[model samples]
Target: MAKKDKSEKKKKSAKLKDAEREARLEISGDLGTAITQASRSLRTVQTRLLTRSGLYSGQEGVVLLLAAEEGLTPGLLAQRLGVKAPTMTRTIGRMEAQGFVERRGSDADGRQTKVYLTETGRATVDRISSANKALERQATQGLSGKEIKVLMKLLAVVEDNLHAQMPAELPEPIDESEDLAAE
Candidate 1:
């Protein structure tokens, strides 16, 4: 009975070691390790800045996108951000409450809502953008110019691959008629 107990203990110990080995192997690969590490590091920086600035991640991106686009619908903002409509709607609502954005009924289509950044939102985006640039420079201290370029290209490829794998509808080219009509 003692021998049998020892044998079972040995098997259990071996299985535990094997599990640990597999976990290590899974994260040892370059793609997995780099992605995990980069996400962790980026989140740390983002959270720090966000905490200090009293902003949320998705909300800040929305502000910057709105700053550039001037007047975009929540549908268009969701498409640009690659998020779902409900998610963008909630974020925009929060921003609206914070006095960062305002929504108005579109003259072209009263049923459709158009989002515009308030002066407060534009100013916040500008401030956050400058802070983000400084934080990014500090984050990429050791990388060379070529390394930075390659890193961006590789990340873009990874993003494209992930989006290519998704089953969602892709964006279409803008209609010239729509642009002229808007003008």
Candidate 2:
């Protein structure tokens, strides 16, 4: 009877271990989906707030960066903003048309162009700051400060992990000539 009881206990423990493993697997699979969904939702909220300040989703970073430093080339802006030069050019053109920023030839270098915020753009800085504060408040409405800090730390770790896995540069193109020679 005692032997049968011990056997039953071992089987129950094995079942529990399997159940825990499945739970961990499910959570690991859900992490990416959760992060993506959260990001989309946050962006939606941010866009809505930015619209009130006469800016779009990507324009705020440009405005804020230009506000801090009066003149920056579109290429520098693209690099800092993690976007391509052409995208930054389009954004600058739109902002110029909207009277938010203007491009001028660099005094130090005749060929280089520098972007500067207009009076309208400078005025919108306060509004942008307010919007950011409001967004933060709303996002952290339920969370404690300690929880928010932990979340930030966890996210940084995740971002670092992802960055570590990404290739530093694209692979070189294969030479068709070499391929033909090999063939």
Best by TM-score: 2
CA deviation > 4 Å runs, candidate 2? 1-29, 167-183
Per-residue lDDT of 106-165 in model 1, one digit per residue for the tens? Answer: 989999999999988877876787768877897777589899999999999988888687
Q: What is the TM-score of each candidate against the true structure?
A: 0.70, 0.74
Task: Give Cα distance to truth, residue 126, candidate 2, Å.
Answer: 0.8
All candidates: CA RMSD (Å): 16.3, 12.4
Per-residue lDDT tens digits of candidate 2, residues 1-183? 999999999999979978986776677577887688678878899899999988989999999999999899999999999999999999999999989999999999999999999999999899889999998898877589999999999999999998788877988987889889988
Each model's C-alpha lDDT?
0.83, 0.92
Count of clashes, each model: 0, 0
